[model samples]
Target chain A: MSRLFRLYEKKRGGRRTGSKTVGSFGEALFFGIFFVVGCGTMAYMLVALAWPEWRANRQFEETTCVLVGKRVGSKETAEGEPVQFRPEFALKYEAAGRAREADGVYDVTNLYSSDEAGVKSVIEQFEVGKKYPCWYDPLDPQRVVLVRGYSLWLYVSLLIPLSFIVIGGGRMIYELAHWNASEERRSVLDSAAAVDWFEAEAGERHFPNVPDGSNQTNSPGTKLAYRLPISATFGWTLFAAMAACILWNALVAGFVVMVVRDIALGEPDWVMALTLLPFAAGGVWLIVYFSRQILVATGVGPTRLEISDHPLVPGMPYEVFLSQAGRLNMRSLEVWLACDERATYHQGTDTRTEIRRVYEYRCFVREDFEIPQGLPFESRCQVQVPEGAMHSFLAIYNEVSWKLIVRGHVKGRPKFEREFQIVVHPALAGQLVS
Target chain B: MMDPRLSLMLDEPQRTFRPGELLAGQFFLEGVRPEEIRAVEVSVLWHTEGKGDEDMAVHFFERIDPDLDDVVDLRQPRRLSTVLPNSPLSYHGQIVKIRWCVRVRAFFWHGKELAAEVPFQLGAVPRPQEAPV
Candidate 1:
C-alpha cells in the first residue's frame, strides 16, 4: 500500500498529500485491477476465439462430408439454469488418404441457445446420408466443420474486452507519462489546452490562461467600445430550481402512491408513512423555493455594462457605462472593481476551494435612486486598474480574476448582485509608476 | 558511485529582469565522462507554487543529444537564451506564488538523471495583500 501511494504521488506531479494516502491507494488499486483484468481478458479472447478462428480459415483443409446423423444436443450450462441446445451432425469424411468419421461443428464459434426449436431448425438444413462440403483440420482429421464462417457473437464478445483495454490502457499511459514530471513538463504534456501562444506578427505574448474578451468586444457598445457580458444570468438559476423541484416532487409522488395503496388495502404501513414525512416536507419546500426563484427572476431586469476599451491594463484610466432597467426604488446601487485569487487543493478525500478578494475599488455608487417603468437608470464612471496589481491568471487549480460587480438594495425586494467579467493585462515597464 | 555535478549560471548578476528583456544562461556538467552522457535538456520556464497544484509554461527549451549532435562535448558550457514573455511576471501571492526559473536536466547511462535550476525574479511586481472585508 505504501509503495502504491508512492507511485501515485509521483504520478500526481509529486504533490505530497499524506492525509489522502488511503484514498489515493484505493484509486490506484482500482485502476491497477482494471488494467490487469483488461490484459488478461484480451489474452483469453485471443487464445479462445481469435486464434482458433484464424486457424480454421487458414489451416483447415476443405473436404467433403457425409452426414450420417443429426440430433438436438442439450448440455447443462450451470446448476439451477436451463440447458442449452446446439445442433450436432455425425460426419464421415476422407482426409490424408484415409476415411475418418467425426461430429461436424457449425462454425468457428459454436452457437448455443436456450430455444431447442432454433437448434432443430439448423439441424434440419441438411439431410442424413447426404454428402456436403466441409472443412477438416489438417493436423486433426477428427476435427471437422460443416460451416467455416465467423459468428456474429465473436465480434460482439470482442467489444467487451476492447472497451476495457481502451479505458484502462489510456489511463495507465496518462499516469505513467505524468510520473516524476516537473510542473513545466506536465503543463506541456496537457495537450487538451495549449499553454500560451506568442504572436510573431505583433511581437506580443498571448496568454492562454487569461479569459478571451473577444465575445465582449464583438458587440459594439452604444457609448463605449465594448459591452461586457453579465456572468450567470438569473434565468438559468430559475430553470435549475424548477428542474430540481419537478424531480423531487416526482420522487415523493412515488412514495405517496405506495402509502395510499397500503391504506386502501386496510394495511396502513405506519412506519413507511412516518419515514416519508421528511421527504414529503422537503418536496413542499422545494416547490416553495422554486416559486420564490421565479418571482425573483421576473422582478429583476437586465443590467448592462460597457467599457471604453477592452483588455484593460493596470494603471490606466478607462470609462465605464452602466445601465439598470426596472420599475423599483433602490436604496443604493454600487459598482465595484474587484480582483480575486482562487485556489483549489485536496483535503483528505475531498477537494476544497478558497477565494480571496485581493483588491477592490468602488467605481460608481448611487444612494436612494428611483427608476420608473420603460426607463433605465444610466450613469457613467471612470475607473483605473490599480498599478502593481496581478493581471488575470488561470491554471488548472488556481486563478486570479478581475470583474465589475453591481450590488443593489431595492425596497420590499431581496438584495441582488450581478457580475461582469473583465480581463486585465500586465502593464509594460514604462507604464508602471515608480 | 557519486552523482554527476550539474550547475546553471545566468548572465544577470542580481537575477532580476523585466518583461521583454533578454534572459541568457548556460549549463555545465562535471565529474562524468562525456561518453556516458545520453542527452541534456535546458529550459527557461515559469511555474506556480503554494496552496494549489503547480502550473507552468516553457518560454524556451533545447535538447542536446550526444548521439544526434556528434561534435559536441557534454561537459562544455552550452548557451541558453530567449526573450522573456510579458505577462505572468513572477507573482508572489497569498495562496499561490508564480516563480520563474531556468532548469538544466542531464540524462546519463543506465537510466540515471540529474537536474538543476536557478530561480529569478521577473517584473518587480510587489507582493499583494488581501483587502479587508
Candidate 2:
C-alpha cells in the first residue's frame, strides 16, 4: 500500500503544476453581463435609430400643413442668346399666435449665379431629370421638399451604429480568448510553486524556508474549482448577447429603409406602422440588454502603472516594480528615448499620430523593468521630465497613465503595475565650510 | 483747384435677408462742400484682380437725382450700365467718402463729367418652411 501510494504521489508530482485553471465563474459572469448588455445596447440603438422617423412623423401629424413651391425659370440655355436667368421668388409667411412681428421683408438673391452651369452639369450626371421634385403637407401646403426621394444622410446614419457593433463585438471576442490563456498560465505557475515548496519542506533542506503564513499560493483552481464552468457559460452568454445586438441593429436598419421606400412610393399609413413596429421592438431590446450588461459587469477596472517618483536624475536609475490589481495582465512592455516632441511611438499595431510640440519619449511596458543600478541622472532623463526638473534632480515621469488596452483576452478586467522614482542628488563641487 | 477729390459712404450699410430677398440702404454725401455740384451719377460696379497687369472692371450706371426720393427699382433701372476708361472709378470704399448708397446697387456721384463705381452687396438666405398650425 505504501509503495503504491508513493508511486502515485511521484506521478502526481511529475505532472506539470500551476497550469492555469480558468475560473469559468468569472468568465461566465463576464459573458452573461456582456450578453445582456450587448443585446440591450443593440435594442436601444434600434429604438434610437427609429426615434427620428417617429418624431418627424408625430410632428408632421401635429402640424397643420406643409408649404409647397417650385423654381419657375427654364434651366436650359437658348440657342444663340445667353441663358435668360429668371430671379428666384422671395415670399414671407408668419407663424400664428406669435406676439412679435417680423422686422422687415426683403428679396433674396443667389450670389453665385455663374456657378449654376457647374451645378446643373453635376446634377445631370446622376441622370436626374430637369424637373426638380418637391413635396409639402397636403393639409398645410406651406412646408416643402425641394427634391423628392433624395436622402444621402440616411446612409451615414445607418453606418455609424453598424460600425460600432462590429468593432465592439470583435474586440470583445479577442479579449475573451486572451484572458483565458492568461488565467491558464497563472494557474500553472501557482500550482508549480506550491508543489515546489511542499517538496522543499519535506526534504528539510537548509535552503531558506518560506516564511510562515506568507507562502500562500495564488491559484484559482485551489480557491474555486467551479469557477471555470461558470466563467465559460457567462462568456458564451455575453457573446450571444452581443450577436443579438448586432442582429437587432441590422433588422432596425432594414426596417427603416423599407419604411422610407414605402413613404417615397406613397404607401398607406397602416402599412407604415406595421412595418415599423418590429424595428422599434428590436431597438428597445438592445437598450435593455446593453444596460443590464453595463450594470452587472462594471467590475472590470483599468490597467495602471504606478511610478514611485518623477524627474529621474542622470546618475540614479529608479527601480520599477510590476504587479496586477484588477482581473487582467499586461503582456508586453517597452522603453524608448526621443528628443523631438513630434516623434511617433508605435506599439504593436497602434500608432501615436499627432504632432506634440514638447520634449517626449516613448516607453512600452508589457510587464515591468527594474534597474538594480539606478538610472543615471543626466540630460537623457530630462526628455521625460518637465523643463523645471531639467535643472533639478533627474526624474522619470510618464505623460499619460498606462492605458488599459487589452492585447488579447478578457475585456474590462483591470490590471495595475507600479514604478518607483529614484532621484540622484548632484555631486558636491567643493569642500563645505561650516 | 477742386483737388479732383472722390469719396463714398452708405447709410445703414449692413442688413440681413432671407432667400430671394433684397436689401436697401441709403448712400450719404460727406466732405463734398463743393462750389457747384453739376451732375451726380452712381455706377454699380463689380471689380476683381486681373491676371498680370490688366485690372478687369464691369459696371452699371444710375443717375441719382438728389431731388428725387431714394426708391430702388429692382426690375428696370434708368440706363444700361457702362464701364469708364483710364480712371476706372477712383473711389473704392477704402479711401473716399463722397458717395451715398441706396437699395441694393444705387449710389450717388456728384461731379462734372465724373463717373464713380459704388460698392454694393447682395446675399441669398435659405428658407426652411415651418409646419402649419
Candidate 3:
C-alpha cells in the first residue's frame, strides 16, 4: 500500500534523483480521455463502413417506382433560421409478386440547401408521373431505398476528433516511457553558469560623466538620484496580456465570419457565432481596462527630486529640493534620503534585482497644506553626508548607493513617487594636516 | 641562479608623500657585474584590492637602462625619482582598499629578474574624530 502511494524514491547518491511512480495523474487522465473519445469515433466509422456493405450485398429486389410529390422547408437552430428546400420523395413500387405502395426519400442523410432552386433542380429531374429505379430487400419488403451508397461525410467528420486523440495519447505514452528527474539537476547547473555570464556582460555597462580611467567610480548616466521599493509607473506585464487578448479575439472573430458564410451556404452553423459573443465582449472590456492603466501611468508626472550639488564629498552639507506643479491635489507630501544596497542575479529566463535599505533620514514633511488651486510649490532642505560613510560605488553584481525619495498622496489621480541618485566621495585630508 | 640579488627601499623618514610631492627611492645590487646587470626600471603607481574588481594606473615610469650602464653596490646605491599626480589618494574603505607604491625591477643578462615594492601613504590628512560632518 505504501509503495502504491509513494511520491519520492530513495536517492542512490547526493541528490534526490529517482522517479517514484510509473505515470503521473495527468498522463493517466489524458490516456483515458484519449481512448474513450478515440474508440467512440472509431465505432462510428465501423458502423458506417459495415452498414453500407450489408445493404449493398443483401438480396434486394429491383423495381420501378413513380414519383408523387416534392417541396421546400425551413428549420430553426442556435445561430439563425436555416431555410432549405427539402424534397419529400413519394413513390409506388411492388415486392414478392404483390402490388404495394410506398412514399419516402432514399438518401437517409439530411442534406439541405439554403436556396429553393437547389431542391427545385433535383426534383425537376423526376416528374410526378415519371418512373425511377428502386431496391427492396426480399427479407423485409417494406425496407426499400431509391439510392444505395456509402456516406462519405461520416468518414470526413472523424478528422477533427481523431486529431485530439492522437495528440493526447502520444504524449501520455511518451511520458510513461522516458520521463525522469535529470532536467531538475541540469537546471541547477544552468542557473550558476547564467549568473557568471550576466556578471561578465554587465561589467561593460557605460554611464554618463564616468571618465575611462578616472579614480572615481560614479557614472554620470545614473538617471534617477534615488531608488524605489517598486517601480509603480511601468505596467508592461498587463499591457502584454492586453495585446495577447486582442490577438486571440481577432482570430476567433475571423473564424466566426467564416462559419457565418458557411451557414449562408445551408450549413446551419449559426451556433458558432453565438458561442463567440461572450468572448468578444470580454476582450473589449479587457482592452479598455488595460489601456486606461497604461495611459494614466505614462501620462502622470512624478514629484521631482533635485540636488544642490551632485557627487558631493563626505563631511560636507548639501541642499535638496522638492517641487511639483499643476493640479497636484495631494493629501500629504514628503521627502527623505535613503542608503540602499542593490544586488542583481539571473533566475531562469528572468533577470531579478533585489534592494535592501541600509538607513533612511527624513528631510521634509507636509501632511497638512492649504494651497490655492492652480498653484505650484517648491521646497528646499539640507542633508549632510556622514564623515566616515562608504562612497557610492557600483560593481558588476553589487552596488552601494544614496538616493532621495519623494512621496505624495492625492484623493484622485495616481499617488506620486520618485527617486533621485546622488554620489558621495570620501572627504580629503588626514587628521594631522587639519 | 640568475635571479637578481638586489634590495630597494624608500629614503623618506615617514615613508609617506602628498599630492605634487617628488618621490625618491634607492636600490643596491650584491656583487653584480656591469655586463650581467642589463637594465633597471622604477614606477610610481596605485592599485585597488578587495571585494570589488581590481584596477591599477601608473602615474610615473622610467627605464634607466639606455642612459646609464654602470654597476652599483651597497656603498653607492642607484637613485630613482618621480613627481606624483593629484587625486586618487590612498583610501581604506569597508569593501575596497587602494594603496600607492613605488616598484623597482632589475633585468639581468639571461631572462632573469628581481622586484621590490615600497608602499607609502598619500592624502591631505585623515579627518579628526568628533568633527562636524
Candidate 4:
C-alpha cells in the first residue's frame, strides 16, 4: 500500500462507508456510466480477439478447403463520406465426409478500408484457385470460411476501450481510498485571513506572542496608515502602464529603424508597408495616451487630502483641504468623502469583490479661475460625517473603507478621477484627536 | 448520570461593549475528568461567517494543561479574560457577517475535541448625547 492510501485506510478503518462502487454521488454516477460502457467495450474487444480461435475449436470441424472465387466491391462507410472496399469470397470445404461450399465471411465486422487499394491487394493474395486451411461447423458443414486465424487488427483495436477502463477504474479506486477529510487545514492560513494561524506573515507580524497577562496591545502605527488622494494600488498600476509604453515604443521603433535601413540599402519589399502600418498606428496612439496620462499625473502635482483630524469622528464636521494645478475649463471640480462596504466572496470559479457606496459627502470648490496651461489651483471644504455610520474596518472577507475622491475636467482634455485611502476610527473619547 | 459536556457563561452579562473594554467570561464543567483532559483553551475571537468564508482571529488565549498525575477539582470553573480589539467589531453586513465571540475549547486524547462559543457585540455603539459624561 502507498503511504497516502495506508494513512487513509487507517483513518477510515477496514469498514467502508457510502456506495461500494464510488465514494461520492457524482463519482458513483460517473462510475456507473463509464464502468458499464467501458467494461462492455473492453469485453467485446477481448472476445473479438479470442473469438476466431474459440469458434474454430468449439462445435466445429476442420477440413481441406479451397478459395474457389473472390471479388472486390466498394461500399459506403458509416459516415457516408469515405468509401471502403470489402472482399467477398467463395470457399469449398469438406466436413463429415461431405462436400460443401459457403459464400462470404461469417459475422465479419472488421474488414474496412478508407482506400480501395488495400482490400484489392488482399484479394490478389487470396487467389481464386488457391487451397487454404478452413473450418466448418460439424452441425452445418456448408457454413465455412477459408480463413480462421487470430487477427492483429483486433489486438490493436482493444486499446480504445482499454484506455477508458484504466482511467475509470483508477478514478473509482482512488475515490474509494479518499483522504483529506479534516475540516481545518494548513492551507487555510494561506488566504491572508484574520486568523491566528502563525502561518501567515502578516498575521505573525501583527499578532505576536507576549507573556500572558500583559495589557499592551500592538504598538501604535505597527501598520502603516493608508494615505489618500491616491492609493498605493494606483502607484504600481501607473508604473506598469509607463513600463508597457516604453517597452512597446522601443520594439516598434526598432522595427521601423530596421525597415528604413533595409529600404536605404535598396532591398525593400513593398509588402513591408502593410506590416509597418500597424506599428505606425500603434506608435501614434501610445504617444497620445502617455501624454494624457503624464499630464494628469505630474501636471496635477498629486491630489492632496487634509483631514481636520487623524481619525474623523462621526457626526463631526471635519475640514478637508484639496488642491490641483492644470489649465482647464472646469465643467466640474469636486472633492467627495465616501465610505464603501466591500464583500469578497467566491462564486463558482471566480473570486468576486463587490463594493457598494454606503455614504458620500461631496463638496465642490466654489471658486472659478481661467489659468491657461501649467498653473496651480487650491481649495478647502468641510463635510459632516453622519452619526451612527459604520466605521472603517477590514476583516478577512469584509471591508468598510473611507476614501477621498477627487474629480476634475480640463478643457479639451479627458475627465480625471483619483481615489485616496484613508482611515476612520469609531468615535472613542481620545481617538478622534490625532 | 454525570454529564460530559462543558457549558460557557459570561462574567458580566452586558451584550454590548466599547472597543478596548475588557471582555471576561468563564467555562463551567459538569462531568469531565481534569486529569484525562489534554487542554482547556479560552480565546477572544472575531470571525466572519456568511456567503464569504469564515475568517477568525484569536486576540487572546488562556490555556490550562493540568498534570495528569495530580488530583484537582474538575468542577472548578475556568475563568477567561481578554481585551477587545479596535478595528473589526460585530457587524452584520450584506454578503459578509462579522461576529466577535469568546470561544472555549476542550481537548481530549485521540482526536476528540469540543468547543463552545459565546458571542458579544463590540465596536462603536452610538451613545445619546445626554446619557453621561
Chain A TM-score of model 4 versus the true structure? 0.42
Tens digits of per-residue lDDT for model 1, A1-434? 66444433432543554424354345556766787898899898888878888888889999898889988887877789989988888888899899998863666666577998888888899899898999888887778888776666777888888877788777766666665554455655673343335533232436545666666788889989999988875667778889999999999999999999999999999999999999999999999888767655678678899999989888888999999998978899999999888988776678888988777889889999798898999999997887777888877888998999988888877778888889988888677655
- In model 4, the clashing pairs are none
Residue range A54-159, candidate 2, lDDT tens digits: 3334432222112222232435565775554332322223333321121111111111233556545533432222333232333444443222231245445555
Per lDDT, the best of the predicted structures is: 1
Model 4 chain A: ten consecutive residues of lowest lDDT: A209-218
Q: Which ten residues in a row have the lowest lDDT in candidate 2 chain A?
A: A393-402
True contacts kept of each: 0.46, 0.00, 0.00, 0.19
Per residue, candidate 3 scores C-alpha lDDT tens digits across A1-434 of 55345554443322333333443555667676886688787776656554544564466668887777654444444576766656557777888788767665655343565777877776677778788888877777766677666666756766756876687677666555434322222222333344545346433323211212232223322233432223333445556767877787788779777877888888866677778778778777777666655544554444545555556666677676566564545678878776665555444456766675655777788875644445656777787766555455554544566766777665555555666666655454451122
Q: What lDDT does candidate 4 reach at residue A403?
A: 72
Q: Which has the greatest DockQ?
A: 1
The best-first sequence of candidates by lDDT reads 1, 4, 3, 2
Candidate 3 overall Cα lDDT vs. reference? 0.60
Say which prediction, candidate 3 or candidate 4, comes out ahead on lDDT.
Answer: 4
Q: Please tell me which model should have the higher TM-score, number 2 or number 4.
A: 4
* Off by more than 4 A, model 2: A1-300, A312-316, A329-434, B1-133
Candidate with the larger lDDT of 1 and 2? 1
Task: Give each model a TM-score.
Answer: 0.75, 0.17, 0.40, 0.50
Decoy 1 TM-score against native: 0.75
DockQ of each: 0.38, 0.00, 0.02, 0.12
C-alpha lDDT of all candidate models, in order: 0.80, 0.33, 0.60, 0.63
Off by over 4 Å in 1: A1-70, A80-82, A89-104, A114-153, A164-205, A233-289, A429-434, B1-6, B27-40, B64-78, B105-115, B130-133
Residue-level lDDT of model 1, residues B1-133, one tens digit each, is: 5568998999898999988899998888888888889778788888788777667777777778888897677678888899888868788888878889999888887667889999999887677763322
